[model samples]
Target: MTGPSKKTERETFAAYCCDEATIDLLKAAAPSRGWSENMVFSGGIAGAVRALGAMPCPEFLIVDLSDSEDPRADVQALAEVCEEGTVVLTIGALNDVGLYRDLLHAGVHDYLVKPLAVDVIKAAMHSAEEAMNAVEEVEEEGPASEGKTIFFIGVRGGMGTSTLAANTAWLSANGGESTALLDLDFHFSSSAIQFDLEPGRGLLDALDNPNRVDGLFLDRAVVKPSEKLSILCTEAAIGVVPRPAEGALEHLVDTMANTYRNVVVDMPRHMVPEQPEVLNTATDIVLITDLSLSSARDCIRLKAYLKTCAPAASVHVVLNKLGAVPAEVEEKDFANSIETEINARVPFDAKAMLLAVQQGTVIADHTKSGKVTAGMKAVNSLFTSGSENADGQKPSWVNKLLQRKAS
Candidate 1:
């Protein structure tokens, strides 16, 4: 008999205050571990408080601050509405340190600045769930943990590629993946700033001494965001530095893949000579694009370019900034024009994304909605299928040849 699906034991989440669009985004990210989410869209802060007060607070709480200028007052008001066990996560516009510190003091479990992704949000939620489960397990058993590596990239620039990559990496690593997000964009890279990280000595160091590369070297190179994730971010000081040699890049990736299952690489779009090496080695590559003519054209160019360079690498295209209203460029037409399939179309969730960047958290941490989480999972699912061949598939000719030789 087959085993039960991983999803069956997953917990549920409740959103006290959330926008319809963000709620949808959160819901999309829910199914990876079989999480089912229920959302209540109360228009504003007061509405959320009333709705939440009426019902038992779910495992997580997501609040939107778009309607208010004073986050302190909003959070204070929200505090009155929440129960002790409900982990409060705020979503908003500001990124001030003072505001974040104040919210933490006010009992906010976490804070996510807006324009968030489903995976980031889910990662946050999972962090809390994991912590709680760990507490329960410690009483019955002992310390338990596992790790994974997740990769994020921009299919095209100005599509919020760095932001999404950083947030997702932060969530998974910080949330529970013990994740490391590598910023591969040589120029104009923003992964460092997104998570308030500064890359002092990093990938460059590892590249310089490829043979010396090891966990100790990486620990020295990467910035630990939370116990869950590390940031191998780009340096803020700008200059066209020498890129790593193909062999060095490969060695670094192989080390990370062997060390952690959840390594996220935010790739540069310039198609450098070594690009294919990075692409081919990754567990998955997320190509971020918007539904615009220029973006579509660029996507097509990229697809054509990749076919020439790394034809065997698995690639998934994500339609970023998909609008609530039917867009002028239909998803089908865009897919056809790009000559690539659309893996996931993230709604234009500006508030959630912005909040996430500012708060230095992923969307999944703040909202429990499965819709947004599902979108991220769709992207993640591309990589989840192990490297083994599917059942009854044809054996490689190389394998057959080896068998005949043995015979």
Candidate 2:
């Protein structure tokens, strides 16, 4: 099958890999090789085929056949939809020489096995570049331009949503990323207090008049506890209803996105008019709940609400306070009951958690090792690795942190 004639332009590259590791390797290796920002990363071969079938193919394409039943046939299917002069690279789990030869003969530019090192992937990309014979410099997009907002909400009150959000943002900041923690609780927020910071008037001012919320105003409004961390919160008077201007939350989140590498929003349990807008702007949503049947039921309802409100945002359910869970509901049963997998479970640590709250700090700062810390580390890994696999495998960084705590 032939596609339209190739328009003369700088060659672009796109990839649909089976896992996050390969995607990370590609993102790290792309920039030094002059690949343009027109890159697309999706899930495996099926996603690549579906996405590219409707659009003009890039000069270079990479797809994974690791999960394919017939690798050769999959490549052949991809070739049928690919335009002429496109260099297709395949990565798979199969390491057989025959399979490599078959893929090469089926119009695949190259085939590499899984467990590939960065250097190997870079070499494969370079080969594709050489095959295309198209090289040009492309502008680099900074992290701020691609900043992501993560929303954390409790499935029920007292689920420790603020704690998770605070620590996640803290970890992001300490991990060398500029991070912001926005507390949207309005009246009763503890995010700022958790960081040992006083509530600032910036959030209230922004909510009152979103039209005046520019980058400069945001910069001045946030409280910087560290070089990379900023907090935007308010302790508004109780009984005072907050009527944020129509676009106030969006404007604030947008401005924060443009300024920080990561933004963590702590959403209140009660749904406000701005809740939908905040969820819609988030790249991820962390719904915190306990292991109780009531929390699980509430989680299902909240998950449905998120699906309807912010369909694009990825939602992860974190089961907190696991120590108090009765024997009547097991984790598996709880997940089944909610119709969603429990991404991370934080064992209840009443003493440590209470101390942290009393001291206006996070558990990580209060206790170095325990079930709670381990769970928090695992939760942080989900964001750092940017993997939706939810396999509950702690990242290497988390392991290092635990090792230090043990020592």
Candidate 3:
């Protein structure tokens, strides 16, 4: 009921051109790819240059170069201010093969002749997305390695799963690792609000069009509140039912793993088609629950489910709101009832948590010495420890190789 009926005005894709014909084609084709007509602007390369001077560049930029006498030079100038991973597509009046080859060599995603057909434009856009994704995949995976994915799911509602996930993710990012916090609850997600960020449509776009889940698409969707931390979340209308394209979750997870050193997913308890695959792909899973009997019963059922669905993943059970435990149940008894050991117990600090929520910050940021912060740190330490070798050191060879590559 709290969700908005219309999509937010965040630009995922943009086109800057003067030609009515090309703009018309793009306007017609945008919706098919989950883009809006408002995303298109009319100023050509000059307009893009002026706009980017004041704001962050979009993930994909389509510019008209048919009017320019020096197309390559104009592109070079545009590239100077563009973000590192932005995919650029150019539309020119000429159809010369030499010109196309020159543009491609200069890192233009693709060059199209004027009087563009809708299908041709769509095909070029797809090619650009795929090409950029392929390059990023190679860069992230290389000979060294892939990233780590940690998933957090609650046993029931109001268990503080999102809180823990957000704090841990912030800590990891602040510790110098490139981290991404992804909230998969499309309709009702508070991850963005928790971090004082405005939610974007990245997750919903990926779900609606799985094939578009690539490095360029992520660049458009992810909101970076800091240099190291990226957040992907959405607050959609309650009337909207998400029907993710097949393999959407898997593709999104794979892309995230390649892009960041640490990936945190705050998953909803309600099952979706991609839930099982996401759980299976996680390197670690944290299950948060309270001390109540209903929570224990749900935890037991979820643990059993994980055993069958994600046997290889390490599951950590966190008991939240520990101070609220009834007199009838002790920690040991609660653990026994749930059939899983309590990896961490977070004491309830109602005042501190409330202050944090009101300030739009995490517990660690609000109070450095609170029980909740301490418990979250302990849980995070487990992940840090698990990342190391048995002797608590990363392999020397891997470090040396990375050093040499950096040099």
**Full-model lDDT for every candidate:** 0.59, 0.72, 0.73
User: Which stretches in model 1 have alpha-carbon errors above 4 Å?
Assistant: 1-151, 174-176, 272-274, 324-328, 370-374, 385-407
Give per-residue CA lDDT, model 3, range 286-385, as digits (tens). Answer: 9888877787788888888888888878899987777764534677898888777889878888898889988888887778886788888887776775
Candidate with maximal lDDT: 3
- TM-score of candidate 1 on Cα atoms, chains taken together: 0.54
Give the CA lDDT, 0 to 100, for residue 229 in model 3. Answer: 88
Tell me the spans in candidate 2 whose CA falls farther than 4 Å from its real position.
1-146, 272-274, 325-328, 354-360, 387-407
The alpha-carbon deviation from the true structure for residue 272 of candidate 1, after best TM-score superposition, in angstroms, is 4.5
Candidate 2's error at 391, in angstroms?
Answer: 25
**C-alpha-based local distance difference test score of model 1:** 0.59
Model 3 CA lDDT for position 399: 36
Report the Cα lDDT for residue 280, model 3. Answer: 70
Each model's TM-score, in the order given? 0.54, 0.59, 0.61
